[model samples]
Target chain A: MTKNDLEQLIETHGNEIYQFCYHLTGCREDADDLYQETLFKAYEIRKKIDKSDVDSPLLKERNYVLGIAIRLQKNLYRKKSRRKEELLDNEQFEYQTELASDFNTEEKVEKDQILAYLRKIIHSLPLKQRKVIYLFYFADMSVKDIGKLLRIPEGTVKSRLNAAKNALRIKMEEKGYE
Target chain B: MNNEEMIREALKLNIDAPEEINEKVLRNAKHKNQGVVFFKVATLAASFCIMTIVGTGLIVKASTGKRLIEYLRGLIDNRSYVYENGTDTIMTVYDNNGEKWEHVEYLDDEVTMSHPLSENETEYNLYLKVTGENGMEHFMNVTAKVNEGQSSEDLYWAIRGDFYRFFSPYTAADEKSQILAGLKEAADNADKDFIRDALIDVSADLENNRRILYEDWPADIWGGEGRYIFFEDLSDLPVGKCIIIINTVYDDEDSFIFEINIDGNQLYVNDVSFNKYSEEYYQEQLEKNLPIYDLR
Candidate 1:
């Protein structure tokens, strides 16, 4: 692609790719990194373009960008088998913003305390469940999409999400947040 | 619970990942390309008989010509396009960290797609083509609303308005689709005007990091029971205020009064977060998405 074409690509599909990365990685910083990696992959492979082969550049780009993102994420996790990294739980994520209200707000204080505990629980989940929880709750990605990224069956992604949700809900209920 | 709803809600969790994932991807892609010298030579040796042709073949012979409605339904539902490797000198930007970004600009050109509104004949088919990202073009067929006895002109404008509604989201004018989705929620609550004309913008106090606009709304627009004020593209709007244009077209105005439910979020947000198909997965999804006919 020439200067003009590359400019057009960025002008057209930049943010869309970023969002895809954001959901896949579960953090703004990670999304940006994945997006950069995906784009660079596309760039190196750009010479193979057969426009007639694909009716829409955006569609082609979406597929390519996402394909790279999934593999990259898997590899990243495999390399980091040491640290016991804690994930952000749905309850804490939901209430993290409402924690600083005035002293008179009894309901708000209770919500804040509950959320703080929820964060602690997420820190204790297994790695796979932790990843599943982030993708579903924070990224809002579809199970089908997650399945594709993980190279797992859609049924698996669906069940993983369901299990993750149930796990969170149960934890919340155990802590009396439901 | 349905897989769709479960998947949708499950996508809202807060997951943590190891840092430096991006750095590894760049190194990986680069390393993979290093071995491309052998991979390319091998693929080239087999390219001729393998794919039959360098491009995807999608020609179907129909005695009665193309079935507009069926063809359209397939395209829209699959969300699959002829996947191609971008053949140009792909100019890409990597923030010092190595993430890809394609900046989107509002190109005012209208993408016109028409299909036969009548199902009785194959000649009346839908043809749709729109301009967006270079390779992934969006194709959709318009359904007939003749049942509602809508005037072609009113239906046209409403659809045109809907096109605006659909495209407005990508242009970062979140109001058109966001309000419509919110109103659909209200319609679920049995609000009569939600469909006819109940779209509104409520982006008042939000500025940074606010994905959806946050604001208060009055009971009605200028006392019109079903009037609507929609935001076309307000990405550049001041944080405290949003811009909106009002539209008040009704079903009675068209002989073919039709109702369309635009999947505005998918159409605009490009939320392919969950879509798992790629050329790598294509050979696999193909077995599932379509069954190959062994004519041999």
Candidate 2:
């Protein structure tokens, strides 16, 4: 693929990719770094695909780019784990508050609170379950697609999704949510 | 709301990336692409130069002459002497005691440089096996910085970093003797607490020394507890016959064997022997359902 093709790909799918990165990292700074590194790696390895494949569907290109983002995020997670660094919980709470301001009504505020709580819970999930949750719910990917992207079986993807949901349900119940 | 709807709703809110990110990513992508292009061009140019020099007879001879000149310059530099004998490039450097040491920089089959270069700044903690004047192998841990632009040869000569004498059976006998005295005194008093404390101190020292020697401790052997030093049941033995065995499993197939022999209040460390086992032997023992420590 040419640089022009990569430029267009990023232009089209940059927001979704960045959102996936944010959900993966739970912080804007790490999301930014992961996003930039993902694009740089995609550009570096662009020649791996045939030039004629440039005419492939936009969905395939988006998945290709997202695949790079997933692998890089996994590696970043591994390095961070080695260093024993935890994600900034305060950053997530601050971001949720900032996001809550955009909604005006009391019902919207309540919904935003629930959403923020869910986000925190999701972030606290183990890496595998969190990844499955992000790709499935946020990225709008199918179980099979997640399996293909993560190189796991579809059954494993379904199991992870179920396990993540169960964990979220347990946390929500503990917080006195129905 | 249901779980799926709640999750989708939560993820969808404020999902847009900061507006500047697109431009930043594009700039980074372009910059990285340019670096890749430059690297490819440089590699191609170097390959072409080498090919041309090899293709021309007089240029090859001139290249040899240039190498000889570099070798002669190295000989005069007193700090180091670099010369090629047949296929091996040997670098000679004098130790602090004025003893000459020759390291083969480039062998015929492989490059045995002391340090390898990486693309980014990497701090390498390495255990260097240096043969002392007594011809006994002594292991020392050295931390070296290998910057991106620096070559391995430069790193080999300019390794000025923190060095720790990681335990050698021969050189560190005096230190071992001190530990033995401490253990003996604690044992003679019939102070089990002091004995345990002494054993714990020895365990901590062994953990630090072994951690430097082998960075990655296998999680299976450690049971993910992150503890390497295991003490055999010290409570069962009597006071005078208190034999403390400190077994440190450094890797799957190797361990640092430390034995404290306290026969009738005479305490001494037998030896700090680093024992290694072959993979086949380890697997065979595993198949026989024997404990890993028994394989030693």
Candidate 3:
């Protein structure tokens, strides 16, 4: 892919990519760093990709970017774990209160509270389960696609999804959310 | 909303990338485009030089009647070897003062120095040979630690270099300065929990398939021998007691623990210990042919 093609690709899928990073990291600072690294790494990889392969469908491109993001995020987590960096804490939830100004007070408050709880719970899930959940729910990917991306059996993907959903359900019910 | 709907809604929350990142990415793309040609040329030139050097080295070795060192299949980092039985065995080729020694771990305990070499002489009967410049050869028999359970002292030598390198980046002056700055900020804010939490996070991260225990420093642990010491001079500061118990990722038998003392803002590691596990557990794992851990 040429520079212009990459620019166009980023322009089209940048938000989704950034959102994926945000969900993976649970913090804006880390998300920003991860997103930038993902884009740059994608660019570097794209340069080596065959020109004929560049014309593949937009969905393939999206998957390609997400794949790079997943690997980069995993590596980042491993490095942070090795360094014994500070854990992701309550500070990530600080932005939940700053939701869209368009929503009315009660609606906004309820939405913010639910989102804060959901994010914290999701963040606390094991990395494998969290990845499946993110790909399935946020990225709107199929079980087959997630399996292909993660290099796991489709049954494994479904099981991880089920496990993640069950955990979320338990946590939500405990919070009195129906 | 139902559970799935609630999850979908939470995940679908609209989040936008920061505008600065977009601009930075575009700038980087433009810069990369300019440098691509140069990078390709430099890479080609470097590859050519490497090929020439390798070609010359191989020719010289062939002319000198020196045997080429052939590593076993599935050798990783010239240290660990993966057996077909799914065991991640530690096979280190050691060079000590021109004397070459190979430490190879086998899956079973039946193989020993006295065991007869198989007919093929390929799979079994591996030997560590030291060759002098004059082509004088000395053969040494090296045994797998699985046969005779590894001692703590043996594990200390085997794993300390890896542990040291893993944590060496944090020992740099700039890294220490950064850590101290963060610690001082937390200290000034009286966030002792943050300091302790940070340490706990470190402990939790390193506790992958390994047990970590916080204990008091015992003088008998190191026996006054401080050869593997990372940090020694912390006599001036008040140090808190925090010890990390590390099970060797290589084998299940040995447990090594080191104490980390937090003195004001500085962190000092004092004393080391290696404790052995029950022989039964080691033998059971061997009999089951189970991989201790997946290094991949």
Candidate 4:
């Protein structure tokens, strides 16, 4: 919980947490602010984090930091959409305007469409299911890791992931995508 | 790209953070005393507990109460027996606020000129779009399958079961004739008695739900999960093979004609499009079910 420990946590896990926040918010600006907020929040309560498990210090720290980010993201979402019950209002879901790669080719165009559809479906998902999906699929986190980060049972994480997958499949099918 | 691949690609976009994030974190952490930190942590923990308890309560209520059944029914009721070019049909449910509760595409095409539902595979996925209590729409895609495969004798009962699931919560006792007209329109010579019995069951179920819930009969309850219909008589009703033609009538509103051969005779069942069958239609049909149009 010292300043040195905080600096090390940021250096080692900061980018990962940043990625998590970016996917959670689906916007870079929000991610940056949330990333900083999460680090500070984690540092504030660093003394309370269960530190007895010396076998996985980084893992413990990652969970603590990511947990704060997720809660903050939920709070932000609730605040943003308090007037409307829609879980992911269109205004809150801002995608990057520029694609990461060039997409002048036909194949890339198709890929872009599919990816956009995927993003829409992901954003369409309920908050809980969306979190599990982003962490598992986008963040490349293991189900066990996600369960720990979300503070839920691993089985619950698995179920939520399955539900999200099924819902996505149905939506993709609706759009004539197998 | 597949979902995982697409997500990986999306997440791969390097997210830039402000350079001053480190300084901000250090300053905020330094400003927080041990007591303040403890207080914030304690407050967060308490909030989490309250959220969990309230969430669990809502989930339990939704699952066991009207919400779950309404959601389940929305999935099933959106299905229709119609010819698709060997292509899947989809059903999407949306709440009043235009938020989708369920979107189920890739439903197995179970209809042809001859067979409406496959005898081999009774399992069918229904896409439901429902508006939740908050007026936001929810979507669900659920499989409607009975474990035991149904025989032709079970078809009427199955149809009746579906009818009950579809209408009981929505249609009142006085509106029984509308259901009869609709069913009669679907299958000509539909036994008035059989249809009446199903209607009565629906009304009874609605009454029971109203009594138990101690609330007014929610209009949303009509199509949902609680329908498990069983007709005592195992005797098969007479149904003959006849060419059935389905066409939408655009000139006189978006009504549909379900023309079928019944008992070596042509029968016509025409009414408003099932998709548009709403509270307004319920009221309209209360006076007189729409007149049938004969194409044969």
Worst 10 residues of 4 chain A by lDDT: A82-91
Which portions of model 4 show Cα errors greater than 4 Å?
A: A28-33, A48-56, A85-104, B1-3, B30-296
Task: Give per-residue CA lDDT, model 2, range B100-211, as digits (tens).
Answer: 2222233332333222111233232322223334433222223333333433332332221111112313235544443334333323433234223433444344333321
Ranking by DockQ: 2, 3, 4, 1
* TM-scores vs. true structure, each candidate: 0.30, 0.44, 0.45, 0.41
| Alpha-carbon runs more than 4 Å astray in model 2 | A47-56, A82-85, A89-103, B18-21, B31-296
What is the C-alpha DockQ of each candidate? 0.04, 0.16, 0.16, 0.13
Give each model's whole-structure lDDT. 0.35, 0.46, 0.47, 0.44
Write candidate 3's Cα lDDT for A49-76 as tens digits. 3336544555566776787788677546
For model 3, the DockQ equals 0.16
| Model 1 segments more than 4 A misplaced | A1-32, A47-60, A84-146, B1-296
Q: State the lDDT at B72 in candidate 3.
A: 28
Candidate 4 lDDT over B169-220, as tens digits, reads 3334333343334333333422334333533543344444321101111111
Model 4: how far is B92 from its true place, Å?
Answer: 23
Docking band of candidate 2: incorrect
lDDT of prediction 1: 0.35
DockQ of 4: 0.13
lDDT of 3 by residue, B20-124 (tens): 999988887786554321111111110000000011101111011012125422111111212211212234544422223334332232121111111111221
Pairs with steric clashes in candidate 3: none
